[model samples]
Target: MFHSVCQVPTAKVCGDGKPSRRGRSFIYRLKDEDQVPQQVCKLFFLSTLGYHPTNDSLVLSVMGKDISTPLAPPKDQRGRHAPANKLDQKPLHEHIESFHPSVSHYRREHAPWRRYLPSDISMKLMYADYIEKDNKCSYESYRKAVKSLNISFTQLGEEQCESCLLQEQHVKADHQGEAAVNCPQCEKWQIHKDSATGSRLHYQSDAERDLPEDTSTRSVDLQKVIMLSRMPGVKSAVFTRRIVAYHETFVSVGKKTNKKNTISVVWHEGIAGRSAAEITSAYAAALEKERDIKHIVYWVDNCSSQNKNWCLFSSLVSIVNSQTISTEDITLKFFHPGHTFMSADSFHHGVEQEMKSRPGGVVFGCSRIV
Candidate 1:
């Protein structure tokens, strides 16, 4: 069988004696006026010399007119050049090829990563890189570089960082001090309430004999500690009554800044009765000697069985109305369940920690722990 074959163009030597038959054949095949135009070769050489096709030449080339003398864009009936239809124009990549060198770097560098990567994925990767970039790089430097290079970059806020979100999700306890710092009530109490209490305390100390005994307002927190019940081997329940009194004395205050001063701690064993009456009686007995105390603000958690019941309310009212007691007005403030950590919780935590540090990690009796 005989095989038919087509002839391939033989390599030709240019003026520099470099052989390139492929380029020559392609140029010749264009067949300008049955021969390749001299300007075609000139333009090719110019392109090789890094001369880019100007906008004017590109417009003419796109319109299928010769680049040497590009025809003016046709005008409409209104005598203005008709705007090119973007839908009919070449693709962005083609336009990039025609763009001048001045802006070529911009177009080449900024091709969006979203074109290849999914938008969400690209954004996350960019944000991660932005954060973990040079440790010493300034914000302005990175931003300017991003702009110049056309990076697919996203800037996330401090809280929006992946590490920050992970940390927040894992956080177990609330920072009470930081929380208190932002509270307006806590701020005012620190500056005003504590200052007033200090003044009253000073006045009482300086002129206790001269001034007649009257009444004053006191703030207190009450909590029940049951370590006495959880004795080493025995499991009999004994409640350890913990009362934290806030006064204007120079004593070391607990962790809770709102509970400004630490006065005295009174503990009533379970033997004394764990009823509402017993609790109120303990509070009354502690303040009864302070005949000057007229109003009292008690901060406690809203445990209906213990503090918020009608029994406790009635007992407070009876004290104010009682002729024997000097207290006139009584206020009960209930804090949020888990967040009621100001004085009562602080005292409870301290007692529990101290008890846990013992040899057996348990408290047998109040006397042993105290």
Candidate 2:
């Protein structure tokens, strides 16, 4: 017989619609699978605070009038064979019906403040458990845990872009021990990204061109369509400061044709031209060192960034699908309005919001779908 304050409280509803039968004679036993026989028929009387949601725990209670029965452990240590009057607990799989919880129906939180969901937190917990099991509680272990947990490091949450699982790995590898380098504005412990503006593509122009054009066709992957939106608000025209902004685009290419892909592009009105070819050309031109000139098909929304097609298919980006160009190329498409690009394009939202946010009290909200 056991009762403790940490156990689930049993409140009997009286005729007057009030809780009654308050008592203190309670006991508790550790929730041990092997100790079931010794713990049954245990009387646990939880004291005050039992009815509160935050105080609930898994604890079995027995009453004075309840009858008792002998029990025996199961041969497999998974179920009790002698509790014939009541079936003992079944295996966890028995309760789960074909459950593969991760990556399915994921709780996608696009909030700039919160990028993770409950399952992601649980996965990190499990990953921590994994670390403890392997006796590898190193910084690298924690970094991997952040990835498996699918969340940013608690401290680096402010650096939303670098907090990505992949980017964390990169930073860890390329930390280079924070040498003292003269920055334009200021210097800090780590090699500040803004100061360094590290080489995105390493150039090997000195090397001979060994690869052929036909063989240069690399695998292009198409990813999920990404959506970008911001919280609505009003503004005034009495500000003295000028406004500045940055625009960006995210491209998701299919691993190969016949597969689906996604691209999330959020750009300013003037910075990223309102043309499909120009936007992609900007990307290709910027990534020339790492990317080869290739034909690209972009299927985006009927927004101004893309020209509106006045045919059976009205979407400007849809014209790519109806094109007659014959070449081994990559195809990118926008995810549905609300979906976000996957692991590939991490900071698409932040880039979009930074650009479209109110500038110099002039409304720059691209609310019009056209």
Candidate 3:
């Protein structure tokens, strides 16, 4: 009977390894009273895109050979006692165990994805599941059971970050509305044909005209760092300190830090350094020891006073002309007004988290850790 059901076109594996609409007959030779397992029937039916079979339905089907003898009915339609078999004599637990194959080993084999989940997140999931189960299982009990099983989970779950969520929403909105899509620039430096043609009107060297000849490689190495906006003010008792942080995220390739990588800070009495001189003073002090760097490009927001003024530019120019250090050129790249999120933002977030964890929500005044 099982062989009869598998006569569909999908039951055959085609030469191209795809399901073809070519019907094929399946014949299974069996001796008298021989039985076929339920797993075989399930795998066979599911292969043909058929619905999965339940245990009760499969047991009562005429197609399957029953493993156990006929069980006596507790009460027939006429209330007569039916003949009993050895299968009816066992307990309810035994019957359930026989009907459902043990999935303990299978579940164990498939639980590797849980390792990427942090313990706290796993505990939260377990707690939620326990609550949803009407509090039948305690969290402590479930935790103990999991610990006894000796499972190791070390990876993070597939959760979206705020930036990713925002990007998704932006894409969806751009599609739905008439707003122009802010597509990511494919090339770092793109020179339009009109701009290039205009620049050729005057006979000048590409270097003299300040036109980028080779966008791929301008110097020996092009390492871009970040200089973020002023972070949250840290307050303690009577004194509040402003925190300025910097991060060299692209200094080395393939090396990543899970924590904040910020350095070189100035702690003023107020929230932050507002004046251009104070900001440049802190910046100069931070670069006092560094001498081997070739090009220092600071990606900062378009702030007029603190970072973008002539004072800061003149300070950098004077430092380059002094020849007191090995640094050659300094460039300040201003980010767009509303879209200036960088590694510095993440670093500031880490700092805020650390500060919140502290007593009285206070981070003491200090310079950026080297």
lDDT values for all models: 0.41, 0.33, 0.41
Q: Which 10-residue window in model 1 sums to the lowest lDDT? A: 246-255
Query: What lDDT tens digits, residue by residue, belong to model 2 across residues 299-365?
Result: 3332334323333123323333434323344444332322222323333433334445643232322
lDDT of 1: 0.41
Clashes of each: 6, 22, 5
Best candidate per TM-score, number? 3
Over 1-370, each residue of candidate 3 has an lDDT whose tens digit, in order, gives 4443422223566788887664533232333345643323444554444446433254235333332434333345663556552222223223222322222211222453332234354555655654574544455655554544443333212222344345446556755532233454212112232333343222122113332211111111111222233234633522543344322222111113222123434343344444677667656754553445565555555557656789988998898778686777766655433334333443444444555565344342224433
For model 2, the superposed segments whose C-alpha errors exceed 4 Å read: 1-239, 244-246, 251-304, 307-330, 337-345, 349-370
Q: How high is the lDDT of residue 355 in model 3?
A: 56
User: In candidate 1, which residue pairs get closer than 3 Å at backbone N, Cα or C atoms, i.e. clash?
Assistant: 214-292, 215-292, 216-292, 216-293, 216-294, 229-238
lDDT of 1 by residue, 123-234 (tens): 3344345456433334444444444444332211111123323333333234433325665544544454354345434423432333223323233444444433334544
Question: Could you tell me the lDDT of residue 125 within candidate 1?
Answer: 42
lDDT leaderboard ranking: 3, 1, 2
Which wins on TM-score, candidate 1 or candidate 2?
Answer: 1
C-alpha TM-score for every candidate: 0.31, 0.23, 0.36
